[model samples]
Target: MKTKILTMTIYKKLTTKIHFFKMKIGINNNNAGIIIFLSVFFVSFNTALSVTKDSITYVKPNEYHGLLLNDTSNSIEKYEIQRLNYSTLYDILNTRNELFGMSLGLNGHYNNFLSYGAIDNNIELGINGRSLTNYYNGKYNLENYSPEFFERIEILKGSDAAVLSGHPNNTFLNFQEIIYNTKIPFTRLWYAQEGGSFISADAIFSQNFSKGWNFTFGFKKMDDRLAFDNMSTDYWNLRFILRYNIDSTSSLSISDNFTNNKTITSGGSDPEQSLNMYNPINSSPYYGKIQMRNFRHDLNVTYSKKMNFFNITNTTYLTSDINERALPRFDESDTLGNTSNTETQIGNRINLDFTFDNIEFKAGSNINTFNSEGTNFFTEYSGVNWNLYSRAELKFTKSTSISGGINYGDDSKNGFIGFGERLEHRLNENSSIYLDHSFISKNGLIYSNDLENEKTNLFIAGLNLETIKIEGYYRIVNSPIFNRLVNEFYTEQYNISDYQAFGGSASYREQVLTDLFDKNDKIDLRLQTRINVIVGNDELKNYYPLFTFNAGLNYMLMINKSELNIGFKAGLLDSKTAPRFIPISNSYITTTNNVGIQTTGLNIYSIMKLGNAFVKIEWENLLNANYYNVAYYPERGQIVKLSVVWSFFD
Candidate 1:
């Protein structure tokens, strides 16, 4: 699942019960056969494991009408894109709960994610509701798109996702982009082979030429070769969408997300010139000559209206970020220092909602206009960022509720604010429970001038059930924000002060072997389990790793129209001290100088189908262990992949 071609991703809430945009599981169309459930989204052969969203259309989990509702607290952790076995998007958001380590590799779109207490970039991303928060160096190419361009993935935690519009953050990673509302005319073709010399591909085309209009087109590509040693990578993506649903609540859209990146890095490696710290030594004396390039364009326009009372969404974007660096010159190592940088942005975002009965209201705003230029010894900056927010929710009964929020901004200096409170209960009918407290303030534009905002203090509790879930958290961050490293190349934005962390997570899923006996018209099974625990002090606990877990097993076999799928995922992350990547400011630091990581990872995949096409064969780490999240950048040992997706219907 890798091409976010022409890239443009949005929505992804496979099955969550919370509200506040972050749109992830919203297209259920209810009728029209939904093109036979979206042809399994790109893998065809459906024995059904997804594509069912009827509980009340779109918004789920706590069931609609945002105003701080989290269906009894699980702060959101949605990630389902059926039958997939990792390939980007931080591999299904790394180690799950609390997001633990992994960056500087796997295409380096960077995400050591653990925004619980401000860590460079502080996490913020969304689709549909706009805002992909890259604010330069916060990284968000989601590692060159895939997972078939998204259909699910939400990770909202803390600061209650700040009502999501970006800018205010503690983590809120959202997505949903598999633009469908087709009226036939579908087309899909894909290819992949990743074990060595890696290569991947995808091509898509969607429909609806008239009557309301809907169109989509996509293309994605990738080529890689690297495990360390000179390094290399190449990528491409192109996506397009045009929609006009002006009826049924209203809609209008236009999108384009383009990508092009080429790399040959040696930004790391030098664990004392490697003599086997599990093999590491890039020492870059100029080994690869350093070439890092990136080109991007995200042009968007959106409008939405749905009313009985109120609902409005507005998004306007124009972004272009270009970077080019060709090194080999710090004193002339043969003279070569080519630099090119261009950054442009024009953004606007808005979301408003209202409900009266038990009370609920939401409001949001975001504005941006930034510019940068370089080439000729680079250095040109510009800014203008704005934001506003509000939230409220009350319910005296019907299972209780309470919420509050406030946010204010002014990235051009002198203004920042954030606060929150929550309490909810619903302990029955499939469970619910929550408790929260927050105080956050984060300002942007690569900060550090006057330096004052980058604070966080969150405390949370959780419980949710239908198949079990649990959460617990405690956090404290005073200055936070860091990216220091001012002399081994370049890096800035520092704020360091107080830091503390706490954690908890529990999970369970069902359908294990279905009915347990008999009733086998070919079979289907499911099982999932999770656990995560964390504790921190000494500033960020070395970027987290106190015990992170995973377990999964899903199988399906329905041989007739052709079907078979088997997937299993296993995990464990214990030892820590992983952070030290900066490669000309890609970011990740936690100095005290050291490197170590304990690993136990596994991934297996299989999906087979014939007529309409489907084939996915995977194996990542599958026993060939040995891991690391930074420092010489290890991880990536046993790899195997093969994909083939086909579809074409008129």
Candidate 2:
């Protein structure tokens, strides 16, 4: 596959740059104990992946479900779920970067990232589980993250789409999926620098002091400085969970979650056409900051009973909050565009699970009410929206299964309808084939009712193959989010009552060698292609085709006493679409169609151990390709970064 080719390139570069060096550090008994403890904790966390379908069947299989599923990768705690994980980041680098208009591309300014999907442990969580943001909006971008704190990043693809609402495609959720059964808390401090610099800290603490009581707490903080002038952020997240087990048959739990962010704009100026345009203050260089806050609390109760040949689990939960954003007005360009927003969401969830001899059953429902509105601190907007989601699953046999579900919701702006089904057949231990189908309808979206409900149908099929040294997948999907309008450039088109998209991707992986330190050394390959055949009445006639091929390989070798991890990644992309940022009102309204491959990206990185610290050097986008990203039309040129990770605890 493509990823393998990329890996080959990485290996060649690594071998050429570094010669074998000998250095030795003594490992005492204390170091052995620590390594053992960390290893056990990591293995336990991985057990979540092998929990046997008989225990829980709702989870979609494979890494496409999220980063948590890359079973073939040597990194025990890090799995690249398709395109969702950081490991995949290297895969993308090894391939070509393509542009498909704004709707589909390697890098666009908008939020199509939100459209992908989530995995287990990640859940359908949004800002307070009320409102969801697009990846381009800085919503889902991983930004700067430490690979150590994460057990896995899961990416659910195709069939898993049934578990989501208010968004399209599968879901992507961070596992943070640490081993909860462990007695001790784990803390990790990580730092990384790309076009910017970032520092992060994460801690997951859990305890079971008695037979029936347990406590768990999670905390995370991330601070990153973007390359763009004044573009930097500080983000914080915390969650507390308490549980009471009633004699192993039932449980009650209460949880609280909080997230806050502060943003500073430094180097770049506001867009020339924005409200800030032509402001007298624009003459001077400046910097400004914005702050956003969100909080959520939930209470849940669960009951399980086993009798005769059947087992059942019932869970109920209450949630509150939706989506809102706020920012302070300060510097020059324009204080008028300064904004503030506050919103609340209240809702309930009920889920059920049933198991029998050859089949398992599951069902769930969700209802949320959003009281949301925001202001530029100038104009006031207020309204409410109602949202709902339901699901059901059925297992036919150990090797084959099918599941289906529907979701419906409404907000002041739009009405939603979604339907989907999945079919899976395991051919053997190493191979399987699967199919997925989905449909969705939307009306009165984005504060417009003149728009009609848009309807879409999606079909997907894929095969998975595994071997002693290699495992991977190949799949494709055909579906559209909204259909086309009868007339082009019609006023109705501007209204955007509905839209549609249909496309698919194919990927693969293989292990080139093993026994580095006599441990497994590896390579990965991937190829993906997607297209949006968009047909909306009026002027919006967008047909976007995007193709990406990526490959990468990393080898770890212990020469003397120090360890060295070297890798290189590269890729190529072909994009066939317009720029992503033209306002909906002006999309296709202009005759100038910006179409091309857009740009490409490449990165080569090496990690070398020098005594107590590790040095990392990376050359990103080595060619310094000229590219235009979707939002705000930011220019992305080549960047070089260097950083270090020190073992302070050890």
Candidate 3:
């Protein structure tokens, strides 16, 4: 099969310059950590003596804009700063930096990070208003687009069957599009290089036209090597967005995203080599090949109107995706047996919202249709699924509220019903408590013939006390299915069983040492800590971690014209069953024993404003810990990135 490849001439030249720049800045391989620490301390110490600002100003909140799912009509400001910080690409460096109590694990690629114990199968990917969850025989690769392409990302921890018409156990990741609105044209160019042979470049252009019309376009390219061998990957992506406002209360938006990614599958390292944490070797003598090309388009129309007694809003969206992948064996020969898959999907959703007094109601319907054709015992299949849902929220008093919803869907082979309810009570101005429960039955995917429908029951309770929060949940699944290695070559086959899990997490955050300093103190200190524990049945325990702990401290200094932010973070993951690579499938299957890993790192970032231009420098993993989120795939060591943004009005 033919695959797309981006030119490497520019990338090679840029990396050479970046290496020289690193050396000129005194950031060599050795002593980089010490230099970063001293630099942060020195700047902070000097700035503390000449305080010019009152307090640290954190990143602005990405408000909970209304979604098409339900009509919860939340106060836009209610969720502002609910967490210590927002989720950004910086958080990808350390799981401890996650503010949503999520555990993120990465494979070799930056876009292949797994969330909540889910490999690629159990999690759903959404961009703008499109869903790329369906897969034929290949992996659902989310690494096609860069983080810079999205304005903000929102993670919904648990399942919301009524709102999200997909599998019940999957977590929801929503990537919001970057809306362009500038008086004058805006353009940006960015380049970054890491320790390894990893280089990336991006360009963005945006303009606003007359009568509330806007257009934005972006292009990105990346070339990265995963191991010491020739196991490398190249990716390219293009995105375009256009928006037109019919009036103040109505608008239409359209987006198109295209991506091409090629990766070399070397089967990772052997068991013995992986066991040695410090110096692992890729023992696989065979190198396979895999490539994916995806194109997605989304169109959304939204309108809102006010009535005498209530306000009504409607949102309708149409999304389509075409995906293709080719996988060949490790012998560098496609003649023996090569596999390929081509899938096309189209989905649409329409939602209506009505708000009156202290009650809000929502109704929505969705339909998804997909077809797949492939080789290697891959039969042609086509299917259409539809769902209908309704939900309502009522506030009895200022301090108490209740919400519930139900959804019904049919996937041709089976019917699914899901329902959920939640009740919340305010203990004080800074504290609240909530209880929630959900029961859902989900139909298997069209491609999985042997896997039967599954049902799950979940119960959760949580308390939020200002800077301290605690949450717990219990889940039980009937007829669950998971992939297991079937042979020494790491070929995976699906297995069906029942599973149960119980987990809880506690997090605390608070500022310290304020009283010891003067009234005009220039230094500020904040501490954050979190602990997560999960226990599963024997079958399920073999695939997920048992315990995770993270702690970090942040310091801010008020400089004369700029502010400095520095932080140190550390995380520990208790031993559990680890995964081994399956080259043919380009996936990982669980192994028997457990492998404990620890990660520690320091991050220093500074944001400076010079008239209309803003500059930021971020250094991640200064300690350069040698660790692996997966068994054999080693994570990136240390990285340095610099970004600048300039805005001007004509």
Candidate 4:
């Protein structure tokens, strides 16, 4: 209780400081106060104003009134399906591995630009494909960064019988979950101030000639130190969006965002050492001026109509270019491989959704093309890849939905691979099941010789329940794919086909006190668990188990005109097996025998509100537990940050 009180007092004092400064800076406006507060809490300026509450708390997926999703479903008799939206930095850091393909299921990665439709804290994530150890030489950051720029973030699980055409699938791919992040423009001008000295400004203008046609543009810039060690970033984002409603049932929309960013690392380099000194910080010389560039563009359109028997909707997405850094393993080390890489991805998705009473259907197709080129030691390897797939789902009733889909594509330089058919069935609201089969073949092109194709079979089942705000779920999955010599990057032709995997996960959350102190204030507690296993050829163990557990306590408090909130979360994970690099290769290899539950660490955050302003503070690795996010590298220890914000309202 003493700790909680102290945290609250600090936050309240900080909030007062923020408000006082805003007024002293010649920004004497109530709305200005709100804007300042929101910017600090949400860590964004892209979304200027929110008529409704931006969020109940300061970070992504913030919780309000003991509810995760903004809205609830009333059709369900027993459980109110609630979607989780707020997640912390730990949720991003604790995910054990990547989900492999597509963006579904429970993956743990940071959603830098927080989008919606995610479960667990690990759900909304952006992953880096390239290695982190060699960033200095400029291998180009191959990471998918998710930033938060939405007014509200919401996640929907289950079959989504109310929305999409068909019943949702029980499997990751079959699941029709949608994350919606809404953005609303402020009637007043847009503006902001960032960095230590409060440097700020805003830009917004628009013109319209026709009733349905309009054009608008906006630009905002903020330079701030996100952390210590001179780790400051300059962010300049520009956006242009146009929308035209053609009649009533069809509409065309186009938008583009250009973000220019500059980041500076303050750490210096090291003296030369033997091969044993593989650590980048210890062996390589570091100078300032390390930089990165990114460019992304997307286009989409939609059409919908209500018919007598069935409602119809058509949507399409075309993303052209998303390009990032190109460089070597390290600038200071000549022994390290020097390489440059750039990739271009073009993709298209089209879906047709229709409904008949309680039964619904969704049919869609997707195509993607990728091209990559390398320089230096990797210069000889340049390739193009393509993938095409078609999917469909049928909903027989509210409680029962089934789906089937097929995928076909060619790697061109590699070979042809295809998925025959997949099916899913929902037994009831709390449980469901699924089955899948696929065919794969690979060719020797960039790194190795010719390899034979293999077949795969997969199965899964799920169960979920929510009682009195308590939520929990369990899942089992069986997957089989062609097993290869993971240690060998370039191999003389060899075949080892037969890899399998099984995984399970569960979670729980309960409100310990609503109106514990105030009618609008409350306290909550939560717990989560996960497990995974894999089997088949190779060393490392025929069986391994991965588990993760998380717990947290949250409270919302109010004193007079001020409102205060605080929360703490801690997690433990045991991966059983750690990754080992194959000598002379860039890939990581691991065995199935690895098993054990090791403690990772803990994280905590606190928030306080005073008048219209708020303060937020966070500390990571509370116990100073040393753990590796990667095989040899130890993650940072004991980090704390304090920020204050005020929102402006008319």
Candidate 5:
């Protein structure tokens, strides 16, 4: 089987049922530690051969389900936070970038990064157990807000994300809110800049106004330019919360999360990579000129109660999102046209936890009512969806445990039921082995009630050792949905296959440098590698990169009232297919088997800290290697960014 990117040359404008996805709700709140959902998104252009005459109309994957069943990236700790100032979510994720079939691409844009070779937006985003996913295009563009806006940013990756809702093919990124208990008002402020241009500012306040009552607020803003021509982004986020403690075990909280953003793009690098033959290059036309403005707001009210034997939580939320787009009609003049879309999601979630001797159980339900009113390019759509799920974990011995559960969901015209199980056996304090299996179903941007639901059978196995960890997975899909990622490109295609993917990852950690200097805790190092092979049908055979690798090393020293830290890291991707972005539609297109060369990029970066306050100076694409992960629309070049945080807490 030969995997290839298929693209269409002729750019077309066709308005149809928009791709929409439900939100993922992670109810455990703070304990919802970071998760890495590994997924591969395959885009179709139109042919198994070279791209036809540098086209525009292309592909999309409709919230494809991804992988990373039981693996999680490194957790963000206070120490790491001190080493790496909390800025954008992309900044935080850079600490552990893409892993195993994951692609972090389309830089210099909004919150859109990290994709599995699929088309469209493949990741879903949420906050405090509520979804931030948009119904218009089934994406939670990772733009605007900074990770500092939340107390914890949990990455819900892969099948493990079943506890939440979204396209099964999507990894859910949920930001957990900060809950304060200080009687005296406290505040924290942060600011950062690069190349003398202000890039970020943040403010947070917390206070306990009265007994059993607490309030919190947070704000963040940023404006900056990237290496791309006619490319820039401005954004801000605001959050407010009020909580009342009914008693030690019960409380009620209300919150509002609002975000707004604007981005200007020049489309992407010409798939042909040709220098403008016209004189006065500056006067030449911009083949792609696109601008997007959007905003999101969520209002939530939550109540929680704790008992000796059980814990319960119920939350009702309303989320509204609006998007405005201006782009050319694919005409010679590239004159711009305007389109807008809006969505509102009203949802309620009830979750419970119970504890018994050697056993733990959980059950939950979610109800969502969604409505979308379209504009120039979209059609109207409205629907209701609900989900019910339950699970139990039993510890048979100190070294052995088993867990399994099932989920059921339905809407007016479609429904699905799935189940998953896991078993773990501890070999020793430093080692263990486990197995995971699940029979699941995923729905992409649904348009017709008569369309058949997609189903998947997934299997995974892994082992954990004191200094090394490894995992592997196998998956099969029936009737997978794929789309061309070009601007205004839409297609309803079902491609079925068996045993589509098989892959694994390995990780290693040590303190080699520190031990050499008799400072065991002063230096830390890590190395990891992953590989994925797509042995799917002819259409998706060899399109995905075959391998990925990453490494990092850091050193720390402390002095009186001051500290120092320095580190360097690198990531690499190798493959023959490249992914490109289209600014107007916020979508991606592939060379579509049009790649004339095998493209590879090795990006090296450095980080440093001085004083007690954390500051970061990074050399992105330090090697300046030609690569696609950096995106192709605006043309990628080496960039050095310096950002620092000024805080009152110090």
Candidate 6:
């Protein structure tokens, strides 16, 4: 109870500070009115001479909420009826599911999150807008923001990146925006609670005005304690969206978001000592007091119009991020270390889509400029990049299509060009096959002069059978940059001349026991599996896993008016260099050789939905396995969490 009170008090104080900051920034009544007037005028002008459609198309309020209730039907359909499931926000908060194609490391409150298949090590450390990956010195600074801030998260895996804006060899995550348009005023209130002293509150208000004008405002606050000791997380966020329908073929949307967050770091323990059956778990040797404060603001505007034969879209965004960290040394000799980093970026994208007879064309260009500075860095860095891409799809028949694209990018540091081709054949209404190949050259990070440009070649083939999917891929990378632990708390990058990787994934989904029961009384089953193997001429084996595998299953049933979803997930990793905690920096350092232990573990979860309320229970490390993904950082023991979310809408 006291802890809860303290968390609330801290939140209140932070909110007060933010309010004062807003005042200092002159967000007073005058500016507020001006903003409103400009928004209204722009929307009005855009729709002045446009045609209105009789029917309105908009996202339903409960679409995302249904996912939290274990209803994956909509998401499955969105993914072309593939075997992908929606990850609930509760699961993310508890670190139960890190999503597919990504890995997450936990050091108390500090999180080291990384996306795979990036050759530019500096891009992993700094903010990379092209890929939407944000980090600070290899630590995931974006973890401070809650997933609720976004309308939806789309996971693009394997060859799916061929159509996206990022490197074709790596997976991409797209955080979609939220726009609400309804004939009547709508409001929603939500509250969620978890066993680990986690609490979240949210409110959303939206309305559709005359002349196809709509607006929405959303606010969220979250407070939580880490599963381990002396760690906590807290954040508050606000989002506003303004949307206008110019006509049946045109629309414009503007969104703004702000967030403030704080987290406390807790260094991990030594695996050898802690995992010993005969010895008691010992505290981390290099424990220190560390805290990080993060503030972020983003503004985005999008306009789309459809002409007689072509469609055009323009999108612009501006983002500002500030982070501050304070670390008190364990010893009294050194003074407290304080560091601050600030980054700002402005970017714009224009795309044109046209269709001529059986051929469809898409052309787009993106330009971005970014500047970053940090107290610990020797000097500030700034860069500008321009990317142009064009794609054409030829429909030979109703069942087959071939598409190809070429991309050229130039930056202050380097220039690169790439091309890809994809052939998709529909076997039937419920199945299809596709083959794709890509060759891409990526520029090095602007902040690092030591790194060189990198290139990759990827080939992928896949089959989709409505409820099942199978895919295989092979990739070769030249001058791949890999991260190496420099000291207890820092990492450096080294280039690998040649590297190769092969991987495959398969998934299946079906309704089970339907023959014995009615259609409405049947059970739903889902299974997904993936494996990867890496090889290289250099001694890169010690730096990366030789083999890795992941498998997951979910079984869902409906009883009366309630739904139950039960799931199990497992992961396996081959011996390789693994991360270890560095208390001083509140980050992780990698180990050399195969000294790191090969690790495996199983996790289980269940969700029950009754009306507008959902209850989720999760048990991590169900097998009580004693393993470590990172060296000297043992995995947590069996931990159970129960969470509940109640939503009300009108």
lDDT of 6 by residue, 254-357 (tens): 87778787766555454443445212234542345567777888777877666767777677878788878776676767554677888787888777778888
Q: What is the lDDT of candidate 4?
A: 0.36
**Off by more than 4 A, model 2:** 1-160, 163-179, 194-197, 203-218, 243-253, 264-335, 374-397, 408-415, 444-447, 467-502, 513-545, 558-564, 576-595, 607-617, 628-650
Rank ordering of all candidates by TM-score, starting from the highest: 5, 3, 6, 2, 4, 1
Each prediction's TM-score versus the true structure = 0.30, 0.62, 0.77, 0.58, 0.78, 0.76
lDDT of 5 by residue, 132-209 (tens): 666556566665555555555566434445545433432466555555555444555454444312255566666565
Give stretches of model 1 more than 4 Å off. 1-102, 108-110, 113-126, 129-141, 144-160, 164-202, 215-223, 227-273, 276-304, 307-309, 312-455, 458-591, 594-629, 634-650
Instruction: Using TM-score as the measure, name the better of candidate 2 and candidate 6.
Output: 6
Best by TM-score: 5
- Say which candidate scores most in lDDT: 1
Cα lDDT tens digits, model 4, 466-559, are: 5222222232212211123332221122345355555555556668788865788888787766555554534423223355567778887767
Q: Each model's C-alpha lDDT?
A: 0.61, 0.40, 0.53, 0.36, 0.56, 0.55
Residue 103 displacement (Å), model 5: 6.9
Winner on lDDT between 1 and 4 is 1
Model 6 TM: 0.76
Using lDDT as the measure, what is the rank order of every candidate, best first? 1, 5, 6, 3, 2, 4
**Candidate 4 Cα outliers beyond 4 Å, as residue runs:** 1-146, 149-240, 245-249, 257-342, 345-347, 367-374, 377-390, 411-449, 453-455, 467-497, 538-545, 558-563, 580-587, 591-597, 608-615, 643-650
Can you list the residue pairs that collide in candidate 3? Answer: none
Candidate 5 weakest ten by summed lDDT:
13-22
Every candidate's CA RMSD: 25.2, 12.1, 9.4, 11.2, 16.2, 10.1
Point out the worst 10-residue segment of candidate 3 by lDDT: 73-82
The TM-score between candidate 2 and the true structure equals 0.62
Which candidate model has the greater TM-score, 3 or 4?
Answer: 3
Scored by lDDT, model 3 comes in at 0.53
* Tens-place lDDT digits, model 2, residues 1-650: 44345445534543232211101111112222232233233324323322332221121111211121212222333423212212212222222111122321211111133232110011122321222322111133232222333345333444444344334334423332222332332222222334434433344455554555556665555555444444455655566656555543444555555555444433133343344311323322122433333343333443444444433433344443333333335555645544444444445444444456654454445454544353432123334444455545556777787877676666556667667788878788777777777665654224232555545555666666673222122212222222222232111232332333344444555555667356534444434444334444222343343444555566666656576777766655455433333211112222223445744566677777765456666777777654433423344345554444433222
